[model samples]
Structures are given as C-alpha cells and as structure tokens.
Target: MTARPILLAAALLLGACSDAPSPHDLSEEAEYFEVSDNSNNTVPVAISLRPIKLDLEIPRHHLASIAHPYKPWAKTIWDRVNLQVLLPDFQFRNTQNLAEFNSQDSADVLRYRIGGLSSDQSFVLLSVNKEYQEVDDFADVHLRAYVNRRKYGNQSEESIQARQPTMFVVNESYLRTPSEKPIVLSCNLRRCNASMVIPASNWPEADRVDFGGTQGVRIEFNYDQKYLRQWQQIHNFVLATIASYIHYPESVL
Candidate 1:
C-alpha cells in the first residue's frame, strides 16, 4: 500500500545518487593514493586540465630514506608518487599583487587551491623558465591564460570565477612583505627588456635560454620552441588538474 510505495521511492532516490558522478569520482582508474580524514573527505593525489589533460600524479617523497637510487617495483608502484603541492611557484599579480615567495598566512598572496580562475577568462599556472636566466634559475614561474568560455558550460561559470583564485607571479624587485620572515627568490641578475610581448607561436627554436620582454603596462613574454614545448605541457597539466581538483579533490588526485 502506501508503505510499499514509500519504500520504492527511497530505493529510486538511492539509485539516482549512485548513478551520478560523485565529487570523489575520477575520470580514470589507476593506482590511487588516497589521503582522507575522519570526515571522509579525500583530496585527489593528482589533477588534469585543458586539451592535453596533463597527468599530475604525485610521488610519495617519504622514500628519501631509501639509499637505493632505482628500484623496478618501487618505480612501478611509486614512480609517480603522490605528495602535496607544497608551495606553488606560480601566482597572479594584480592588487597588492606582487607577492614573491611560498609562505602561508598571506591573504594578499593567492591560495594554492587546485582550481582557480579569473574574470579575464584566464587560468593561472606555475612553471619554470629555463631559457631566460632572469627567471630560469628562479625557483618557479607563473603563467596566466584566459579560459575560453565556450569550453566550460555556462552553469559552472560562477563557481569558476568566485572559487578559482587568481594566481600571480610577481617580479622579484617588489618589496618583500616579511611574513614568517618571507624572502623573495633571488635570480641571476641580468638586464632584459620587458616591453615586448613575444608570441609563443612565433618563438624561435633553441636550447634552454630565456628571452627578454617589453617593458610597459602591457608587457609581452616569449619562449623559444624548446621552452615552448615544456611550457605547453606543464601549462596544460596544471590547468587541467586545477579544474578537476577544484571540482572534486578526491577524484582527480
């Protein structure tokens, strides 16, 4: 009677919940390194983003005690180990925006959440500059890009903007805000023009060496083919991971 229908309704609701992709669900199935708490919330050990969907598998760094340099089984099991992204080398430069270090408790500095977006329709990334000596030897590099709206659905736009924090990679010359005794990363001192914006497609192919940029309000940065390839890969990987991690920390990593 009425009781029977009530039980059936409950069953249907349970089925619906089971069918939907949970936030903890990942697009792929592989060796999963899960970290969860009593709340049962688990952050993904890796993340993927963009057209390339770069894999962001973390390797457990606890193995530092092992004297063995290489182990096949260890390589297979822990090759791409899972560890927290300690301090991101990339961020945005807007407000008091020119932050230059990896320290906590700095609200002005962008938080290292898995997914952060911007009003300019761009995503921020952390990378390295091997070509330019100014940033090459520097610990990390920040890359910013506006995401094409058509790609991500409209319904997700609000979350994408508000939740996704804008990342900044500031010039080292800025005043170092001393929080927890924060220090700016010192790089090889070399003079380079910051006025020009070098298009990635027009970059020349070369070894690990960074080029100069135009100095102005709208500055341009360019990377030759060698560095371009790496930039593209890392960019895609970090972005994709951010997208997924922000949405579902448990599933992506």
Candidate 2:
C-alpha cells in the first residue's frame, strides 16, 4: 500500500510539471529582416514573441558602447512594442472617450524599434485613420486635464509643490502648424521638457506626436530634454527613417 501511494504521488507531480507553461517555441514563426539606412548602417531586425518574462543577458559586443558600463542586461523597453498592428479592439477615436471607441471595429498599423548605443533609443510609430484635427483636440483636452489634476487635485500641497517646476505649459510660438499644436514646454532648474507630446518627464522624456495630414502616424519616443526645441526635425527624421525599414504588405506609411 505504501509503495502504491508513493507511485501515485510521483505521477501527480510529473503531470503538474507537464501542464506548466513552457517557452512557446516561436523561432520558426519569427520574421527576419536587415534594416539598412541610406548611409549603409545596418542592424538585424526580428519580430518574434517575447522569449521570457525576465531580463535577457546583453552580449559583450553591445556592452562596449556604454559610457559607464555595469552589469548589463536587457528587458522589454515597451510592452506595446510587440503589437505589430493595432486591431479594432485597441483603436481609440479619442482617448478621452475610451468606452465608445472600444465598441467600434477598426484597425491601425504600428511599427517600433530599439536602437542607438547599447539599445538606449527606441520609438513606436502608429498609423491611424483619424485626422490631424482630432489628434490635436485629443492632446489639448488631455493637457488641460493633466494640468488641472496637478493644480487642484486631492494630492498633498507638498507633493504638488515638488512637481510644479517640471509641470508642462503650452508654448505659444510653436503652435503654428496643426502638427505643432500638441507641443508643450516645461522647465525645472536642471532641464526643460520641450516636446510636442504629452506626459512629460525629466531625463528621457516619453514624447509623442500625431504626424498629421495624409499619413496620420502617431510617433512616440524617448529622448533627452535638451532636444526639445528640435522636436519637429526629430519627428520628420524618425518617420522617414522607420519608413525605410518597413516593406510592402507591412508598411505603416
């Protein structure tokens, strides 16, 4: 009887282990490409399901570029990077009214990349059907709400005062083009947030923009605050550069 019980317990343990989630082998399903620019700089591109939930070990070759290199590892910079195409479920006519948009069936193109020294630079460009005016309105509404929350929300006075300096405000000058409508400016003692994007930050601001007109691509990037004044130029360059990498059926342009 004791031997039989032990065997049954061993079988149950093995069964549980078998049922556990293992790394789904997607290596064969992954699409591979060589992304090259006009200047002939090339990098390997692979669109594959994330291998694991943990950080990945960075190869020694890539670590050499870091200024103050330490125990280097890699992790998903953006969770949304894996979403090659934004399906109907993810589309938003206006972020302000998410419930209404969530009910509609629409699709959008999205492309992203991790680049620059030690893979420090990254951006996600999304192409939606919405017009430039709608995008501007979305940003304007959000900016006002963000400011109001900081100024009048239930946060403690000390907390509000601490964040006051880094808070963003509209730059009247750059509000020339519809593309520039979303741009705002903010400065602390150390640096300023000067991008035509929302949700400001300090070191590497997570900036965003709706590149209006025929191609309604929304671009989001991480950049140093010092490059805020050249936001327009950066927008154009990222669009053009990323456009080169995307081929026919998958192109977001």
Tens-digit lDDT track of model 1 for 1-253: 0111000000101122334444333223334333223322232234342211224433222111111112121121112222123223333222233232224434222222221111111112222221111212222433221112232445575654332211122332542111111111111121111111112222233310121221111111221222321333333343343334333112322
Worst 10 residues of 1 by lDDT: 3-12
Error of 1 at 70 (Å): 46
Q: Which candidate is the best by lDDT?
A: 2
Q: Compose the digit string of candidate 2's lDDT tens values, residues 16-95.
A: 23433332421123222221233222222333212111122322211112111111122112111211212222231233
TM-score of model 2 vs. true structure: 0.28
RMSD of 1: 23.1
**TM-scores, in order shown?**
0.17, 0.28
What is the Å distance of residue 39 in model 1 from its true position?
15
